[model samples]
Target: MEATKRLDATEQALMLITELSMKHGALMFYQAGGCCEGTQPQCFEKSSFYLRTGDVCIGTIYEFEFWLDKDLFDYWKHMHFTLDVTEGIGAGGFSLETPLGKTFIIKYRLFSELELQNLEAVRINEI
Candidate 1:
């Protein structure tokens, strides 16, 4: 069986990613588990967010890595995530898309048994 990628993005999210990358140079996304960002996916210039040891990178979009907090990854390891964009600002948060009148969100579903077995391995952050 072929590997099933653990993450993906919507068409709108892809278009926005291109725009952000053009302006920001390199981009990365963090699935905000809680706190200030309130579970939204937050986009940042790759250099801005510090990757702590053990953070998990599930996949990428247009060469931009999408990461999750270690604890969050542990909690959702069995699920699949699809990144999406919507027409609103993220409340009190500073994701790059917020200023553009968009908010990044995650739509999730449980993986099938076969898909779970075929899932691409997640990488542990070392940078």
Candidate 2:
């Protein structure tokens, strides 16, 4: 099926971050071993994710990351393979359907807001 607005914990986290910046949380996405065999199973992460945009492949993009506290993290932890579950299998093969008549596709695996912040800190520290 074609997705109209795909979302994972990262994307959700991103939404949460954009909605409530500085929130702490963790989100997880499911990654099947590809649509074939012997592929590596892994997870994509987005810490303090926030925002939405568009991509060429998926049409629209609902940028998400992680940003939540302990309670929030706990909430997210149990939302794997079920709640907050979207499409894609690691990498850039995911999509989702939304009620707003738009579709989102994740074309890459990047860090969320928190991860970005962490990276920024690392960069500043190195500077």
Candidate 3:
């Protein structure tokens, strides 16, 4: 399905990438299977452009490569995505929300620090 609303969030993401590109030259949002509820975004230099066995190509804008895992691309084939911007959030990311109220948020972060910290603390405490 088409995006729910104008991809304003994506536009903001692209804008950020544009600024980052000046220094990094290349960047991409890598979609990998995380052992959790939502997907993880890994940003790196653009030279790392190798397609995996089941990768689906998304459109490229602002000199950035975009791709999605095959499973994820097919999973939301009928839903719409939109972007919501708020102050201090620095232009959030796309979100898929269905009429029934199920929502999925896609965002780009430098790393998974929160998850790592939580896991480390929990594992240390358990020992």
Q: Rank by TM-score, descending?
A: 1, 3, 2
Q: Pick by lDDT: which candidate is best?
A: 1
Better of 1 and 3 by TM-score: 1
Question: What would the per-residue lDDT of candidate 3 be over residues 30-113, giving only the tens digit for each residue?
Answer: 444645424534345674656566665443445455556666755532323332222332212332112213322354332244
Which scores better on lDDT, 2 or 3?
3
> Lowest lDDT 10-mer window, candidate 1?
31-40
Model 3, runs deviating above 4 Å: 1-11, 36-38, 80-127
lDDT per residue (tens digit) for residues 84-117 in model 1: 9989774556689888888888999999998987
Which candidate number has the best TM-score?
1
Clashes of 1: 0
| Prediction 2 TM-score vs. true | 0.17
Give the candidate order by descending lDDT. 1, 3, 2
Alpha-carbon TM-score of each model against the true structure? 0.93, 0.17, 0.48
lDDT of 2 by residue, 8-69 (tens): 33455345333332332333222223353112212234422222221011111233322222
